[model samples]
Target: MLKSMRENVKSLKWVLWLVVAAFVVSIFFIWGASGKLTGDDAGNTLAVIGRKKISGDDYLQALRNRIEAIKSQYQEIDRAFIEQLNLPQQVLEQLVEQTLLVEQARAMRLRASDEELRDRITSIPGLQQNGKFVGYEMYKRVLQYNHINLSEFEHSLRQDIVLDKMIRLLTAGLAVTPDEVWSDYQKASDSAGIDLLILETSKVSLDEAPSAAEVQAFFEARKGAYLIPEKREGLAVFLKAEDLKKEIELSEKDIENYYQANLSRFTNPESVRVGRIWLPFEGKDKALVEAEGRRVLERLGAGGDFAALARELSKDAKASGGGDYGFYDWQSLPQPERDEIHRLTSGQTSDLIAEADGLAVIRVTEKTAATTTPLAGASAQIRSILLDEKARQLADTRIAKIEKEAKSARSLETALRKAGLKGESTGLLKNGEAWSDNDPSGAVGTALFGLKEKEVSAPVYTYTGVGLVELRKVEAPRPAAFEEVKADVETALVNERKMETSRARLAALGRRLEEKNWEDIAARNGFEFKTVEAHKRDQYIAIVGESKTADDLAFTLPLNEASAPFDFETGTAVLRVRDRKTVTREEFENVKETQTAQILNQKKNMFLQAYLAKLKQEKGIQIKYDKFLQLTQDVLSRYESAKQ
Candidate 1:
């Protein structure tokens, strides 16, 4: 189970991507504590960080919140799948980091006052009605309806305020020096061309055959890799939500009640949806910026694609979305831009509008009038929503009953019989194997592999609905005999030899690279000799694909100097710097200010991450292993006492 859990957590590459993507977004999701840990809470603590104690209950809530967030990205995610992904631990790590950041803020004497917290909460778009806070009672009701505890949410929000303050305090003064700007400019503008000697690993052949002893030795060295994965056989009872939905019958009263109770959801304000192409005039000449904006507007007038042009030239972050600014409330927008959008009809383009920062051309895509959805018009949608809600409620009630019975009886089949549900037999399935398409969330696989023989699992939710599993048998992986895997061993040996031979040949070629002509050496050795045209730092190489090592060598290696053998996926290769280009001082000066600010922001982010990593290392996180194990089992429904 641990091995499977580890497999599902994202790799380091994904973590790095998240570091950039969530740098700002992360502040919102970090649920924090009140900094008042009592002895009672400490008894149930999952982890300790200095004076901070993360209780089991807090951890559970954090895990639940994290699961809901994950569900937004993966609609089919359920309890079993969450367990498989080791999300409980992931959430714990996040909480620990939040604690650390909060602690640092307090140490720095940063405080989020009650007024600030109140302002922040009232300012939230969800908690507002017509741009006004929906009073105290309505606020509590809204939070309750969403299953958010008011106190916990407030505390978490307060911590977020503190963290934001600290981040601003730390990064506000950071700026790139003149030398740093020049260095970044060089990296962006410089290009390099390389002469290559390539040896394809697949084409390499081994004339000599390995002895029996060598093959045996290779197999022995990698015995664990050769073992078959563990498998499990189980019985399960699944209830599809769609099937339950078919049985639900919504009355007219139900639709009316839902409409009345959730009137805010049915209200629509007057709004305009516009696509904008903004040209900023911060660093560039204002005349040039306006000229470029006019050219783009002229292209639009001549039937050019708005979205395509936006993607190609717009400077806004939403440029990737084809410059879509989305719908904005009629009153929220400012100035002549709003007036310009209001004047244009749907699908009509606006004339170039001047703003404080830049020139923008707006295209009005849609205009909506203020209105409330009447019950007669919303009946079909309300009925569907009520049907889904009631179906889920019924499903949860039934699953809870089944879980109760299974726990008391210790037999999933008997519990199914009591519930008048048929038990389906799952044939032996290896770890990580999906039983069927119905289990797209991998809930069945997660339940089956985590259970012991004759042990019944808690209610496992799947893409379709919910289910319970009973493990009947477990097949532990075992080592294969030498003769049984002889052919596999020989294949492995041959591949290893191919790599070794390619590396050896490349090493030999590297020695003569400076003495002989590159093409002559390549021709004599039957390797390909080619020159990759000059490309920027981020561009992909022709034969080598995209590689940081290759990029570094290309930019750093002196002209006519040969590089050491660099091993890429397809083969090994040596490169000689053939040509280079450097940007002129005039060109660098053109974008110096913009490049400096961009590089400074990137550097600050890197420094922040490195600082946090070092802080975490120095103040080591201590876990209460027994409590953590209990928490994991409790969350996954592994313990008999875990179910509601």
Candidate 2:
């Protein structure tokens, strides 16, 4: 369909326009077309996506924005985890894709109309209050606070709208057939039971231990494997948040100021846990719905079970769970319900209330009045906060001075002595070794390793507080002594032999599997034989664990036919399908429509992705690898510097 649409562009233009009209009413957010195309700066261009160039600054800003977004999700996000995300590559890919999409929209003359743009902006939940736009002034102020240019933001948002329009236009022709849906449903629902023999590698033993000659030969062959990394020695002084508490002093005025500044921290809003039995007015007599609401209220008033009645009679989605809406902050409950709830005490039922769609009888199972801790009551916590804040400030000042002194004196010991502070000796530590768990990203080691012998480092943030490190000594990497690595070499040799023996044993068992009873064969070979209950093909098999190989063999192998040995990280396994379960005709029919919709959506995504790839190829996307690497290093370095 995509190929046909591309080949007959003029004929399908009207059809695509009609599809675009149909889509505008449903999708809230959409991609926009290109704005202000600029020539690429050779030195700064990160990538060229067709005519539009993504500059280094643009990539950095986008990367920072993405990091900020991720920070909100992970409270304790660290550099190691961020690096693992490989976000530089991902962000660049996204920018290139977005640019391609915007260009495509421009070519097709697909644009977001002024009215649609206005609707999209106003409908942004952050820019609205109580389901109405907060007006242009407040919206502008909010954007200003976040350092966003109003025009730039809108253009970016418009680009998103146009990009989405182009994608939807392309994918609109894709379809999923009823037969395809049924096939997908059956594939996902099919299950199998299997007898598995897992030969534990750890339990496998070598027939005999390797001789000293063998160990020596292995060590000689891989001497670099036992090479010790360069080590550093240093005297380090640590400052902790708690250590500076003695120097902190707070006045009553200080506590009061803090209490006012952080008022929300001390305030607890009033809330109610409400349970409701709703009788909808739709497709039923209004009077009958009102009568049902009254009956439910009466039952609750007479000390009857509210949850039981709600489960039996309520038409709401929460009916199965006893119609509990959990807790709602006082200001969040809608008008009539809020007023009625406030009047009722805990355990009291509300009178039949008329709602737009239904009559509801709500019960207040619990209520908590709003509270703000008095200044006097919060004084202790306030003092603690003030002390921590002041201590950190003091630590920063002292560390800054120490860093200067250490740099000038060229000795951490001299600097500490002059400052009347004692330092602890960090006995020689190897490069890449974790000196402190709080410094998991190994910033301290990186700083120290980059220094010459006897050189002191700038202040390093250690999560707990701030400190400085000095490279007192440097040990060059060297091959390990025979005695020093004897135990390690022996262990490695034994483990390797065990693995080799396990493979051979499994192979022997595989050769005899068809001729012998599985249990008897496994027991004779010192392997464990087990059977897992029937489970879907995708489901985790506790006995077999998580092996795609095992799963495939269990389902594909004929019943009573044994499988050959399959290797796993921890063990080796042979499997036999004992029983098989397939999706029933009734089961397939029950979810046929839902399965069809899911398959359609999946097909649409696949088509869109392939279309984008083709477009990208045609546009001749080019990335400057050296510049990309420099940008990645800059991002990581900035992050590290910020930690310091």
Candidate 3:
């Protein structure tokens, strides 16, 4: 369609008016648009859309209700997402948007009943797992973790349902035909296939500098192109996660399969009791200490307190507390360390054991032999274990054949085909870290990083049970070859030069603008005062009469102050600072009318919230958020813990 439209436009060059008409009709009229406004606290609903009202009472209630809802839904603590709510602007906009959307849903006769509501709520993806609604406990906790009230969330959810239904109704049959699909495919796949010879300044001599007249004309034509963009100068500490958090959305089947596959992790590893004591390698007469420890064990065998003996004589940091080594099962400890500890049982203390730093005395305090851990007993761990198995399964499926075939194959080029595979080759891939070149599961990442050149692992598993993958080839890090990126280097140099020249122009122009030299600068630089009439805040449009740089600089100019030099993407334009005015009532009406619709939506939101609350109150809804949170932790923790 775009290609056809472009072609049509080209063909109708004589009828350019049609293009303008098409834009105006399709974009502004039919689709409709809203402006995000900076507004005053008018203590009013801009407008009510449907039945939901934003009465003064409703507005105040809405604010209080939103706050309480937030308190109910999430941990009252700081997190990145949570911090976003703290922003003054964000909070205000968010509340307003919510009110509008919810009330709008109500106005259209869009609604769900108690049973209908319950059914819809259960189906929400936010609270589903393994193709089933998460337990009531998990559901509540998930809401809390997200820092939202259950009522508010359902209110939000109901609004979404209503909106979704509206969208479906609106967009029904609003689709691209096969012609459209083919059109897209053609434009996307069509090759411009440009191969042109170029001559540059490097090819030209210094004597070939533009003639004075030509230079002036060129400068005049492109003067507005160079300008600085508006900039935010506040200090910002950008949040960058050291490790990408896993974002695994699992299917019910995958979860179930995963649960079935990793049953062992779900069970607590038959709780084993162990105590540890350490002797420093530098301890004087270590052999004597060992002998003494043995004698102490002998005393314990003769009914002495082992913990007391450990505290009195053992040379371990933990000995400070009478060797009351904390309780833990073997699985909780590091594997190599746990393996040694696992051999000991209740009443049996190890002899002077040498591990790393020093000799250690140890005793087993308690033990629980292998027991069948019930589903209820380890649901959290089971969920995670299941998910990991699923990721690994998926990863293995992806790479298993490649891994096996690569061993016997001569080259990756041949093996990839024989295994029916494509290695997602890219230099941008971080070593040992995930790149979204493949499934985004990090399974491919691990396989790629784990391999040593040709070394291959069988269908390797991933943190998510996406499936398995096999390592194929590893590319060693190397600087880019000049031949490979000569064009890129040239482009970079050109861009750099352009930026420098543009900034100089802006700086010079800014001086002229400051001195009321608009006419002189316009004539001298071949520019003019660009006017952008009736543009609302945050509206994206070309500034009429002014260059982009000048417009940007103008926006930055303090009230009654001249703008300094600025640079835009195209070029520099030092804008003469002009008057800034508050948007008129007409502008506010445009916004107010829209906000009124939102107020209507807020009414619906409130109604739904009240509706759900009543249902909970009447039906006696019960939930344990902690249990649910624990379940989420169990399912999600695999991505992090399994790798370790």
Highest TM-score: which candidate?
2
Report the lDDT tens digits of candidate 2 across residue range 359-379.
Answer: 778788898788887988878
TM-score of 2: 0.58
Sort the predicted structures by TM-score, highest score first: 2, 1, 3
Q: On residues 1-644, what C-alpha lDDT tens digit does candidate 1 reach at each position?
A: 33422331212222222331342124334563332222356467777887777788777666655654564354244456776788877877777777788789989999889999988777765444455765666556545543446776677667778878998888988877898888778878898878888887788988988999999999999887887667788998877777899888877888899889867656655656788887889888989998898899889999999999989988876789998877632222335667787788889998778765677788888877768868897777677667755676687789889888988998888888998888988778776577776677666877787788889976676546677789998878788878878999998898788877877897886568886478888888988787878777867777678878888888889988888888877778888888888888889888988898799889888877887888788888776543454455444531111111
TM-scores of the models, in the given order?
0.48, 0.58, 0.24
lDDT, candidate 3, at 244? 18
- In terms of lDDT, the best-performing candidate is 1
lDDT of 1 at 465: 66
Cα deviation at 433, candidate 2, in Å, is 2.7
Error of 1 at 410 (Å): 2.0
lDDT of residue 148 for candidate 3 = 42
lDDT of 3: 0.44
Predicted candidate 2, C-alpha RMSD: 12.7
Model 3 lDDT tens row, 1-644: 33533332222321222222332122212111111121133333332323222223333233333433343344232223333564322333343444454444555787756676678756655444457765565556544533446665454444555666754553454333444444333322222111111112222223233444554444455544433322111100111111112434555666555556766544434555566665565746767766765686578778888777777767755677776555532223333345566787777776665543355666778866775446555466555554444444344344445545656773444566775645534233444455443335444455455454444444432222222233443444445444444444445445546656555555554434545435555556544344344333333434222344443444454643545544444444443334554434444444454445444454555665665445334433222212222233343343233211
Candidate 2: stretches off by over 4 Å: 1-116, 119-195, 199-218, 221-236, 249-257, 260-263, 328-334, 372-380, 406-432, 436-441, 449-458, 470-484, 497-556, 578-644
Using lDDT as the measure, what is the rank order of every candidate, best first? 1, 2, 3
Q: Which runs in model 1 stand beyond 4 Å of their true positions?
A: 1-158, 161-224, 250-388, 425-432, 448-453, 481-567, 570-576, 579-644
